[model samples]
Target: MDLHIVDLIESLNNFDENPSARLSNSIIISDYPGLISYLIQNLSGINIKILRQLLEYIPEQILEEILINETLPSKLIEHIKTQPPDYDSIKILSDIYDESIYEQLVDSEVLSKLVYSIQGAGPKMCENLVKVLVFISKHKMQEILSIPNSRNFGEILIYRLNRAQGIEKKLMLKTVTDIIFSFPDYFYINDLKVVCDIVVDSLSNQEEEILTENYEALTALMDVKDFFDLKYRFSEIYEVLQVPEGNSYILKIQDRIYSMISN
Candidate 1:
């Protein structure tokens, strides 16, 4: 083990033992400028708890500088492809606010790997991966949309949404809505119909948060008028909307859908 890593481990252990020592230990750890790069390089071997602590304590500006200067995003993507995907490392990467990191990820074609990973990921891991994709889509929609089989990625999200429950389902619904809003023209007709179906089915959900997300998703889908024809599912949507009576927002969404169909 490298001396710096050994020292970092010791510092983390001390911090863990005496939570009050956090400030001083964090300062000591931050002095080692290459710490972030070294951690990324040895992500597979490092303890996830230690990694999370180091990342959390490191100042954002310093972390950003190290990430940009070290070209760590490329290395992280390489690790994802070549090794067992490290959820903690990927989670760390996802939490980063740097646009350059995401740009490199997209340039290196990381989206496909991420989308593929979702199929096998555990629920928490799946949510983290989807959150990363949501971040990338927000920053680089055109690049993500330009990738081959991008629509397939959207379909996978819809598939996940159908099976997901609780917070996982809500996140997927929000992700789908954001994607539709960002690139409404990118989805194929079949995928758009499936998304609409998901939204319509979700209308009967009693959870206010889920219902709000479903409304936003439906609104986004309405933008893709060329592909999404609400008429086919009007009866289903109307029936579902009836289950949630007296809610003004749901009532408004119901009214909007009715107007769209009538026009």
Candidate 2:
């Protein structure tokens, strides 16, 4: 074994499950490959405790790079699923936006695990998970929404949207709207009324960006036969534009709503 790998093993072997042990001989970015190799070689004996601690210290970029690679080991993925999904790492991975990574994630069942695992994860982690789902939806709209757990994932996002505020709320709205715009078939058939209702409420929000995104999504929804339910909400939509301080974007939203209802 390489001297550093030897030292790393010694450190793990000597670890007493104490914080200080984690601090001692900690894995850095350069050492991740060695750690991954060690984990792969000792899959049966891979120490979950040590692996969790190591993952906490691994850089987000390195973790994402590993996930994006075609050779990402199942053992490593299993360990990652065993642990809470890291928000920073998921965020980094979400930025890659490749269909292969999406396919691999679905193939390995990592994406489903991540989606189902959202219930107990922290709010920020849940937000990042939704962000990752949104990115996946952008490339593989049908593939992602068709996951067996897709409705669960969508429900979690709607639940989060209900409780989110400020930028977090905007992000969730963007994600939901992206789905609504891109996959009208799934959006209409899926039990996604909560998502649609929340987005409709957001159309009346004071934030221009949120209102614009929601209106554009609604406009897209207008093209779908089943989404005429939004017609009933036009009164509330026009009410929002009644605000005296409305801006140009608000006027555009008004125009959009008018065009949809008129035609």
Clash totals in order: 0, 0
TM for candidate 2 is 0.57
Model 1 — TM-score against the truth?
0.57
List candidate 2 stretches off by more than 4 Å: 3-131, 147-149, 164-172, 182-193, 200-205, 208-211, 221-227, 230-233, 241-253, 261-263
Cα displacement (Å) at residue 211, model 2:
4.6
**How well is each residue in 1-263 modelled by candidate 1, as lDDT tens digits?**
56865676666655562343463445554455556555655655354445555555654534564556465666666666776656766777666635655565564446667766766578767666766776676666666567675655566566677787887688778877887787777667777788877777666655666887887777677667775554558667656654266688767876886676557
| Colliding residue pairs in candidate 2 | none
lDDT of 2 by residue, 1-263 (tens): 67887778667766654544364447666776766566445643334345444445444634554444444344445545666556544544444445554445444366666676676777667766776676555556566677776776777776777777877677677777777677666544443556556666765555655666566666665666676654645556556543236467756766776766766
Deviation in angstroms for 96 in model 1?
A: 8.5
